[model samples]
Target: MSNDVFTPSRPAPGRTRFTTGPLPVLLASALWGTTGTAATYAPASAGALSIGAATMGFGGILLCLVAGRSALRVLRSAPVGLLLTGALSIAVYPLAFYSSMALAGVAVGTVVTLGSAPVFAAVVERVLDGVRLDGRWALAAAVTVGGGVLLITDGVQLGDAGGAVAGTLLGLLAGLSYAMYSWVAARILRGGRHGSRAVMGAMFGSAALVLLPVFAWTGGPLLSTGVGVAVTAYLAVVPMGLAYVLFGAGLRHTPVRVATTLSLLEPVVAALLGVFVVGERLGAMAWLGMAGIGIGLVLVLTRR
Candidate 1:
């Protein structure tokens, strides 16, 4: 994850202004928008399994090598409880997400899953961790969640159609899992940046191990399909791998609320990408729906 490499450094006095620390997060999110179109190239014959495993493996190795001994220490020094917990918790998302993308389209998969994450994160952090959401953020949440609902339903048609159902459920579950991941990773990174990065990679590796078998059966086909394969690599390395690292970095600096709020931008970005990059044409209503999302984000940023 090249994104991880640019984790914003802690600022000394007079060092960080408003945009000072969020640069990596912004860049990472931008690159993350590239995932959907890229995955189209992977072998249609292969499921998302191979794609998930290969990327995690590659990302883990890259992180381990770059961080060296510090990375080693996260695996070695972690108490049993935390290590097992991290491994088990981290494993759920990639399996859910890549498969979700295969079952649904990239536009649907990424937007739906990540769209729900902040809402879930807010609730989880508030109840489980006792974090609170104030007035403006709540409004922001409503607008964002509403926008997401529109995006997912594709003009607000809610039905039992198999593809739609799979996309909605998987995406919801993925969002929850991602929230958990962010929460747990934030804990590991709290000690220090070096130690944090190491532990995160180790955690990713631990989770990646569980996803290996799924890939074993399907990976060959993925490599055979040029575009899908390229997309898979991009998803694996950038969003899955690098994004996780940068996400960790951002979480370390921002509060759970702010972090969750900022994450809402992901789905909005995905929707835009679908529009421009993938030529996903939206009718006027859909375009208006997307505009609502933009307005919601603006409100979130500016609301007192």
Candidate 2:
């Protein structure tokens, strides 16, 4: 759950100028790659809000304890617009994600949703944020998307099934949520003068507030067994809680492409889990698709 995504540093004497800053940021996505697998066992008792609240709350504790009074000051100063942006963005993933999974299936929902985040981010940055994109970035994106398609088709079935349609829609929503979170987080980071921790903390607090009623009304989790509670706690702590902090912090320090590309490992792991852990079947064609996706993703990550 907790990843070393942000580490303050001074440049070494002979380090490449462009490659300065923390390595933790670049590593964050790889750390985040474990999310889906971990969340598989989360408590059915908890809804997205409760799960998200637990995660944000626990993660915020870490930042608060580390920053002390400064953290509180940052929270106080963060503008209402920025807070709403963070809360709304953060709210999207949990609410829509599980809904998609329930309506569709894991493969259809997760791939379409999470896979498209970077593409959306790239577009938003170019069109709205006024960031420039290079030719290689274009090629990299092409390969990346192609690879994702290969993986999704290979790993998941997407005929005219009712579930597939729902899942695909959910996946689309997931991508949109990812885009919103990235953009809003960027706003908070810049507007708060790098007070990202405080901004995130408040955002989580707001999300928790939104979900509190749901949590109370639900009368607890679907899981009554000990295993259920354990699963929920793990998901809350690791995937939802820890993963977001790593992701947010990494975004603060790393290239968007690097972080997003690395995050692709999530589906790869998911596919593997489907086969080995869950006893799901995959065909030879699917294996080839997985290979292509892995290769394409590697290219995207390794290319200059």
Candidate 3:
């Protein structure tokens, strides 16, 4: 699950960038989009909490292993408050994200979680860091988030209002958690005091410590069947571990807002997976919604 595709190359004359190109980030996001589809294969006994815990807990360890001494150093030397903040977000994100999908189905949950992240990220930056949103970003966000809203408009069944409501709320939590971690991680990378690998490893590892006990309570079912075990392993190794490695690479040089916008790819791919692999049905409007999100993503990336 290595991502050699993100290896840095020499920049053009007078240009210097260490971050990965969009291709790598897009590829990583495509991998992440598979999480919901993969989770669908898990046994019914494997709850969302267990799925999230196994993915992050195991993936965090793998990331730490990949980062080695740098990861340890960052974890030890980083400010306690910063580490705690990042870790709290990390711990909550997967739990809420997976729960959202479990309750709301893949397409809607993925859309809500990833679609709202850029907005949350923008607000976090503006309020805390005093960064201002540009018109292009505002336009892109509007179109993308509007598309996400379209996805859930007619998708939820009449009697499932409670589940839909709870799922959407959890999705918001996931989005905010994601934005917080991304902003914090990007800020840390901007400082040049830690590499992306170290930051990801430290943040996720700390989160794993917080999540392990929850996994103990809920994860036994994930190991009950071969299919469950395999799905869990795939989620950890590919989407959670390898994808984050590529995400870390991208974050090295990309602005946090841009990075969050680029991540819209995840939901688009997830929607397709929900329809094809997960056997979820989507109407023409849902397809159009996916297209709108894609268009918005293209606009944002090209505007940069």
Candidate maximizing lDDT: 3
Which candidate number maximizes TM-score? 3
TM-score of each: 0.82, 0.78, 0.90
Per-residue lDDT tens digits of candidate 2, residues 1-304?
A: 2221233454344334223322343344444445455556666555554544444444445444544554455557667676676667666666577667656666656667666777777777778678887776666566656656766665454655886776677767777777776676665665435444555555665655554455455425624557656755565556655555556665564456445555666666677776887777887755665676666565654554
Off by over 4 Å in 2: 1-35, 38-71, 158-160, 190-192
Give per-candidate clash totals: 9, 4, 0
Local lDDT at 203 for model 2: 65
Sort the predicted structures by TM-score, highest score first.
3, 1, 2
Candidate ranking (lDDT, best to worst): 3, 1, 2
List the pairs of residues colliding in candidate 2.
Answer: 43-232, 45-221, 45-222, 113-171
lDDT of 3 by residue, 1-304 (tens): 2331223344442223423545557778899988878888899888999999999988988888888888888877778787889999999998999899888876667778888898899999999899988999888888887777676564656238898889989999999999999888777666666777888888988898988888999999899999988998899999999999888777866767777878888877877887788777878777787788788887777774
Model 2, backbone clash pairs (residues 3+ apart or across chains), number:
4
> Ten residues in a row with the worst lDDT in model 1?
12-21
Clashing pairs in 1: 1-242, 38-231, 39-231, 41-227, 41-228, 41-229, 42-227, 42-228, 42-229
Cα error of candidate 1 at position 68, Å: 2.0
Clashes of 3: 0
lDDT of each: 0.65, 0.59, 0.81
